[model samples]
Target: MARGKPDLAALETRIGRDFADKALLRWALTHVSAAAQRPDSYERLEFLGDRVLGLAVAHMLFEAFPDDSEGELSRRLAALVRKETCAEVAELWGVGPYIRLGEGEAQTGGRKKRAILGDICEAIIGAAFLDGGAAAAEAIVRAAFGPKMHEAGRSLRDAKTALQEWAQARRLAPPRYRLASRSGPDHAPSFELAVEIEGFEPAVGAGSSKRAAEQAAAAAFMAREGVTE
Candidate 1:
């Protein structure tokens, strides 16, 4: 257990569902940093929840866009399931306050980190699935992400593309991206990338792949520059 327990009951109220097994909800909010000494953490739940989210999102897209091509649907799916989008949904549900982080992580602003919030969001979905079955998970996903899916389907561009267009419109040089660092295991490495524009300070971002990192970096730069797409 971490220092303070989260209000799981309030979380259930927000999500419009109650957990049959409250332990699942607790585990969902437990980050690996907080559960290093315990057997339970959100990692396993995140894994399961990722799959569940995928299925639900896929089905939603399939039904929502009968005329869209497979490739188009896939792009929408990718946009919807990305770490950034998950973090947005987590923030919407006020998941940050409920997350249980280790002392060091908490001190370092772990609650506001996109990765941590996104993982916990998925873990919560996984907990919902385990406690109440697929229906429970689907309901939560649909409620949380339904509007996002609709919006993405209408107009959504990848971060890199959007950033490039922003630069081009202003007649500025294309943004330059560089590898900042790499960490984690070879089996599942994390990449950090830095994006620099001619007149602005550089912004860094991290992700599981180089392209993903670049996209993240581009997104960071866009946010810093107040450029929205």
Candidate 2:
């Protein structure tokens, strides 16, 4: 880990929100492992922030994609609000260094863990909401996540769902995923899975988890089939 304290002021500038209650921001950044008491940790804030993120993203989608059907909007919302997306946003804002982890967690590189980063991102949103109410929280969410909505060729729907739908549209069996291989140690394992649809060539994809591997395989199939969702 880097020496000395992280500059919270700089983080505020990057996030575009200055906390009236500076302590709240600090609270949000405090990992459970680092807290004196679990109640003082980011868990509660993360829960509230999760809801706030959904609300803000849902509102943004409703306004920006007026022509999109409810299903489309819902798909977009899911893609944007997922933990991976939240972790990506936190990385964009350089939040890892600011996270307060216990020495054990820090030694294990907790700062860069996607799950921790994602939860901290939501905790920060929850902090913003409490510090400045709905308007402030909405503004922060929009600034952080809005541009992601228009990234070129971004898949709005879950790949697994889209692939299943694609197969159903053609009266084919639903996509089947089989674990082709597994490698790496127990602490950090890698998975390779193949997705197959009847009458179509199978596609292979890899990830750290089975579900992620399945999604990757489905997405590969969709790309090869020229499917858009």
Candidate 3:
């Protein structure tokens, strides 16, 4: 029913590491929801991968852009290691297909879920780390998320992207930007938009257009959250 071992060899090739203990690589893609139905679970691997991934991404961020300030580096780190980004990597690696899911999770599109995919990606990294070492794990994570650090660094001023990524990672809808107050009109339109992050307080921003106001609010939110750029 699973059909030919989910082509872990392909995944291993993508990871650029040949697994001596094939079980480890397989386990990395397992999820608790799927484990409940099957016997293997990725929870432990996820735990290990979490640290492995954090360190690798952190190191890459540190070395990639030498002139970056601490705050700017931190923001880049967050952009790469964030759940949304990991999920993107997981999807790229086809980790979701190998995941064993329970009835409900599988039925409800568990494989496509960002949180679940992100967790599996982390687990896979942990598995690589355990099977090999920091270097091995770092190689894998760097391959997957390395470009993102560069892109995020370049888009530091683009707060809208930041806000969208942040909101999506939390599994919430995008932030709603509303004009809380407006002054002047026609010749000179000023807007005060309340950019509300779901489950968090709203940050107000002002700009010439609605989109500009939203971007302003997102920037304000990032600043308040101690995110640079």
Candidate 4:
């Protein structure tokens, strides 16, 4: 292993796969900020891993829920593949400690940031795919996300949808979302959004994208209003 690189053997043990190409594994753990000064990073791997994850999850949901409609399966898939869920999986696999972050990002708690963790999770999957093909990647996804897929299939609704339904039940106007602010670099900008429901104080949330920020704000609002599903 490289001096500062994560213990590849340990990581393999956790994810249940050994990489034939150690370089790919290292690339998977490299954050963009770290890549800014290097020749490689996890972004490309993350892109591939995103698709691999979707395919693996979709297949799992299809077999697991033979009776579910397309819409229902999509909802569960979306919930399972969201950044928060990916971050949860990364945390479960102890990926935070393995990620290679830049000095500034490391100081600012990048390891714990949902976006970085989630991206790293996907990048690892991508690396697995490249190193050992689809079987390896599928195995990792199934191990990491299988249980969550089952639970989400049983009960999973986007925060925005849940909040709208809650408001409608009470005959209140649907919640409104507004982009409050945007910052950071073009490649990795942060978004802040405010979500408001009639007769209640608006809540603000931040994320890597406008939709994610909106969802976060909606989730916060729902929590404050004691909405659960």
Candidate 5:
């Protein structure tokens, strides 16, 4: 069963934001499965938070990389605002314990789910925005993502996109992915996929999701081919 009310005060301290209206924070942490109504879930907040994160990250990139071209800035923005980055931020904030998941989702390890973590991260940003405006949202985003933004040698392109571009530059056909195998239970399945490029051996990767497996395969292929960003 879902737990009683989570300690939002501790969550606020961790994320470095205090909500004027605590209900928004509660709503932000609420998963759809635990919500009495779908609208009461974090979905709406997530949508708004996604936009807020993009704008905040874009602005930060503009100021931080004065010498970077528009394309470079765009790539950096993409990296910062990606779901993976958001999920990392959520993990850093220790948000999992506070998420309100239904019994089934809780049992299935929904707290550790990448998608859920990322969505709740954005939802928290949305709540911050609603409670204290853009400044509040940007503050939280900066505190969490700012250090990562300045990290040198970070690959802006996701592995799949990077691999595709690598193949195109070499006049090779686009890489193709095939599902090699799937294992585990329905709630926590693992996927194995192979990515093949012309004139090269296929690289295999495994992950909890097909897209992740595909990206892993692409990264593996690049590694084997001595490709680097």
Candidate 6:
């Protein structure tokens, strides 16, 4: 970590709302990797932020999608909590540019890392909650997620879950994923997969990793099924 402070002023601009307790915002942006190098990193605050984030999202989903079952709400929450989604949210404010990273973490694309960005976003919410309470956090959440929530209402479906639900509801067998193989160097690997749905032709998918490939396969199957609801 650098001896000097990370720019809270810039972060406030990114946040679009200032914190009463500025320290909370500082801690929220602080990453564990950064903290290891910096005097005060955001892990502790991140932990609090993680819980606050989950709760805030859960409450919002519960209220907004009244007819949605717990399972449905959980699915939406899962989609939002993923590193990919969080990183996209951070990208809105160029939040990555403001992170205080350790010497090593900085060198290897830490700024754009999805896991780091997601964690930081959660920590910031935690910080916001601490400084300004649920109301402030809610404002941020609504603004950040407004578009996606509206879109989800028009058409919302997750392939993996949809496939599972399809099988269960029809009293058919569940889908199966076969990791056909993986290749590439240790730093990066490519995965090939074949998803076998009973009574249907297998679907193939490739991804940077096995899990990703499986998800892709699931999505393929979902598309084939014309997934809805």
Better of 1 and 6 by lDDT: 1
Roughly what TM-score does model 1 have, to 2 decimal places?
A: 0.74
Candidate 3, residues 103-194: lDDT per residue as tens digits?
66676677777667877888888888888889988888888888776563345435877777777876988888877987753323467898
lDDT on C-alpha atoms for all candidate structures: 0.84, 0.89, 0.75, 0.85, 0.88, 0.72
In model 1, which runs have C-alpha deviations exceeding 4 angstroms? 1-6, 152-157, 160-179, 182-191, 194-212, 218-229
Best by TM-score: 4
Model 3 misplaced regions, further than 4 Å = 1-5, 36-40, 152-229
TM-score of model number 2: 0.75
For candidate 6, give the lDDT of residue 128.
83
Clashes of each: 0, 0, 2, 0, 0, 2
| Superposed Cα deviation of residue 20, candidate 6 (Å) | 2.5
Local error of candidate 2 at 87, Å?
1.0
> Which residue pairs does candidate 6 place in steric collision?
1-37, 30-42
Better candidate by lDDT, 1 or 2: 2
User: Residue 7 deviation, candidate 5, in Å?
Assistant: 1.6
TM-score of 3: 0.65
**Which 10-residue window in model 6 sums to the lowest lDDT?**
150-159
For residues 40-115, write the lDDT of model 4, one tens digit per residue.
8898889999999999999999999999999889888988887778888889888887887777677778888888
Off by over 4 Å in 5: 1-6, 176-214, 224-226
Give lDDT tens digits, candidate 6, residues 101-123.
Answer: 66666776778766677767877
Model 2: per-residue Cα lDDT over 1-229, one tens digit each? 2479877899999999989999999999998778888899999999999999999999999999999998889999989987778888999989988888888778777788777788889999999999999999999999999999999877677789888988899899989999999986543457999999879899998875687789889989888989876
Give me the overall lDDT of model 5.
0.88
